[model samples]
Target: MDKTPLTDPALAQLFTQARTYNSWSDRPVDDATVRQLYALVSAGPTTANSHPGRFVFIRSAAARARLRPHLSAGNVEKTMAAPCCVIVAYDTRFHEFMPQLFPSRDFSATFAGKDAVIADTAMRSSTLAGAYLILAARALGLDAGPMSGFDKDTLEAEFFPDGRWKANFLCNIGYGTDDQLFPRNPRLAFEQACLDL
Candidate 1:
């Protein structure tokens, strides 16, 4: 298998040049693209293949209106204006799927009666899946604005009525413009962020 590196342009498009957008154009993100994004992102690996992540794409004015009251004041306009806003959540009963995801053995027993273990995997693995979604969206020529400025409890009550799933974070997706971007923030060097140990 070839281990060829990505081209500079591709790297820039997905990482170096990617920005958390606050403003988007009038063009909308079609449903087909959203489904394609999910298919591409679902291939990403997760702990125990828990695959707890679930998403609610708020593309309609009525749904966005329902989501508005849960958001922080600062996040209101940006979220409502984006072509699509996603409610990234996790399933508390994720272990139920373990027999299918990790079918080599019966792993569901590991979390059968453990609520804490279930919660931990739900949050951690869902977050990883959310990251995969963001990257997949970028690769498909879209921008993602991942944020956490919302009331999780309120969102869950509004979106997840059965209490089966819980909100982790919110992300607005679209083709962004430089108009709302603040200056690029500084990043830590590898020496500052990592340790050999």
Candidate 2:
């Protein structure tokens, strides 16, 4: 496959210029946009195409109310104010769809009986998918605030009482406001953070 580099503006939208918004505008996110965001996220690669990520978009007042108590004190106001809060979760039984996802052959048996591998792969793939969700939303002209400041155990119990899915992280998405933005933080240089073997 031949591909050209994306335009500078596109790159900026997806990375450098994109901010983690802590405040959102009053603009509402419609269901169609949410669905489109997931369509893009689902196309991202995952381990053996396990594709474990499951998303729950909390947009309605009732849903937000249900989510409130699970948030950390610092995350509550921002999350509640955002137009949508997504629960990025992983399906524990994702391997069962290996025949469909991988297609060439069934890889279900490789993970089904292995608890550790299942948990590790599910978490890894779901985290990757969650990252895709962020980038996808940005590409679609939306802002995202990825967060981890929530009570995982209780949140999972509240959202996934069936035990089939487990929460990995949370992300609030919508039209963002600069109302709560702080200065951009610095990142480690390659020499400081990576090894060139």
Candidate 3:
């Protein structure tokens, strides 16, 4: 595949002009678009291709009601107003799929008895997938508001009662409104945030 820089508009859409929205328009994200978003997100690389992320897209009134009690006070209104709220989660038994994901060799045993390694890998990779989700949503002309302000324990119990998947974060998705937006914040310059090594 030939690698080329993305067009300026694409860059702006995915990063420069993209904002974490707080208000959503009445427009809804259709199921087909959500499916496309996942197809893009799943293609992103993960540690040993562990691919641990599991998403629960809350689009119904009943699902949102179930999630409402778990959100922080500040996040409640915007989240409930959005057309969709995605529960970005990680699978605890992610390594079980290693044989299929990393078929060149047996990598599942590396995480079999090591609880710490399993948790760490799953969390890290799932978070990467969450970031991919945001980018994918933007690429598809959807808006995103990713937040961590929620009751983790209660949310996990409420959404993942089986103890298999754990919530990583929540992201509200839809057509967003700038009515509730604040001025764009500054980001660290390369010199301030990176090292030449």
Can you write out model 2's per-residue Cα lDDT over 1-197, one digit (the tens) per residue? 88999999999999999999999998999989998999999899999988999999999999999999999999999999999999999999999888889899878679868999999999999999999999999999999999999999899889999999999999999999999998999999999999989
Looking at model 1, residue 157 earns an lDDT score of 91
| Global Cα lDDT for candidate 1 | 0.92
Runs in model 3 lying further than 4 Å from the true structure: none
Local distance difference test, each candidate = 0.92, 0.95, 0.96
Task: List RMSD in Å for every model shown.
Answer: 1.1, 1.0, 0.9
- Candidate order (lDDT): 3, 2, 1
For candidate 2, what is the TM-score? 0.97
Please write out the lDDT profile of model 1 over residues 1-197, one tens digit for every residue. 98999999999989998889999987899989999989987899988788999999999999999999999999999999998999999999988888888889898678989999889989999999899989999999999999999998888999999999999999999989888998889999999999998
Model 2 RMSD, rounded to 1 decimal: 1.0
Clashing pairs in 1: none
Query: What TM-score do all the candidates reach, one by one?
Result: 0.97, 0.97, 0.98
RMSD of 3: 0.9
Tell me the tens digit of each residue's lDDT in model 3 across 41-110.
9999999888999999999999999999999999999999999999999999999999899989898579
